[model samples]
Target: MSVSGHLATITSAEENAFIFDSVANGNNAWFGLSDAETEGTFTWVTGELLDYTNWFTGEPNNDAILGEDFGEFKADGFWNDLPSAAKASYLVEYSTSVPTPPGIMLLMIALTCLILQRKRIIFKTE
Candidate 1:
């Protein structure tokens, strides 16, 4: 199946630490950074501005021999560029627009009141 959602891009040290500690501690995963579009510049899948990066030293070396272009989160929490064919776990994020609980409750109350008023009108007419 095709996966959706933007890749996780580290914007700050805190974010990096959190992701490293929580997600990257023991697993290698595919993150959002990639130079597949351009040679040197990396961009997140979300299309957000490239405000932060945490590349390991000498990473994204774009080793022409290896043909590394996709970003990978190593077990050490540092990032490196690997070939797109590299096998690794991946993370997917989703954004949803949903009504708040309060809003749902208010809508329910309004519907109840409208139903009661309609019943009363029907009874009077009968």
Candidate 2:
């Protein structure tokens, strides 16, 4: 499934696990990019080579307990490829412009205002 241009790849099999990060970096709405690979080479639509690999232990083994043949992938908080007999879904994110939304903008502004208010109050009392 394609969500906002971020494609979510999943198996129709009920045992397959979904590969995506809906809450990426603590944000609920985020885009996850999953690329298909063969022979240790990835072919992502983004055109950037994915070299970030820190999968959970015992993961990406491609165990055929449910089924197999789809392939495998993993990121810090996401993983893919499971039993073809199991069902799965993909939740993806995409950006309309070249730059993505600054998720921390509001937080930064809030902190700045908080600091300023504190300083003003302290100086007033002094």
Candidate 3:
């Protein structure tokens, strides 16, 4: 089946680091950030609140000549603005719903460990 996914919208340092280590591979990759509509109004493609940012020093500097508007993760794990059509790797987040709050990360981890154990149910009642 065809699944729908959106470009990654990073909201925390941990998420950014996860994306970097998991897929960025120290190379440039586009995420779900951009100011294409307004000159300086950046928003996530998934309609997430513009809460967290990891821009590199003096970055986004939306170049007047090149018209940089899209957000990309640089090699150093920081954000930068680039023009559309830039040939770079990209990440897609398959959340399929609102992004989860970071506060639930530990709970998710614990549940994942339980799943990995592959323990079968010892009792069942109907």
Candidate 4:
């Protein structure tokens, strides 16, 4: 499915954390949140319920006169609503995969090797 189709499913804190960490690296980026159809009722582009939101303090104020209907992740990892025409990078979420850190992968490999070695030693003694 497209990112818009899956964006509403970002219901977990881990998913939110990953998105914030990935997109908020000293730069602002757009996401799927929007209220283009009806102000104050933010929804995903795919029409899914925007059940998970991390808006910054005093945000989603719809304070712009031209209509601020799109959501963006600021450089500080806070969320803010912006005009759709605003030029900024956007974030697209894929439901099929979760990004794993290199350090975690290395630790898993090391643990696996240690367990296999211990098994081999036990078998030899028996």
For residues 52-88, write the lDDT of model 4, one tens digit per residue. Answer: 7788999988966868998887777778899877898
Ordered from best to worst lDDT, the candidate numbers read 3, 1, 4, 2
Q: Over 4 Å off in model 2, which ranges?
A: 1-4, 8-45, 64-80, 83-85, 97-126
lDDT of 2: 0.44
How high is the CA lDDT of each candidate model?
0.82, 0.44, 0.86, 0.76
Q: Write the per-residue lDDT of candidate 2 for residues 1-126, one digit (tens) a residue.
A: 323555432332221223333333322221233222452343444555555543347645555454433333433443444444544343443645544347777778889999999999999999
Rate residue 14 of model 3 by lDDT: 95
Clashing pairs in 1: none
Backbone clash pairs for candidate 4 read none
- Superposing all C-alpha atoms, what RMSD in Å does each candidate have to the true structure? 7.6, 11.5, 10.7, 8.4
Write model 1 residue lDDT over 38-102, tens digit each, in one string.
88888888787887777899987988888899988888888889998889997656566655688
Global Cα lDDT for candidate 1: 0.82
**Per-residue lDDT value at 124 in model 1:** 100
The alpha-carbon lDDT assigned to residue 52 of candidate 3 equals 93
How displaced is residue 51 in candidate 2, in Å?
A: 1.3
Regions of model 3 farther than 4 Å from truth: 95-126
Best by lDDT: 3
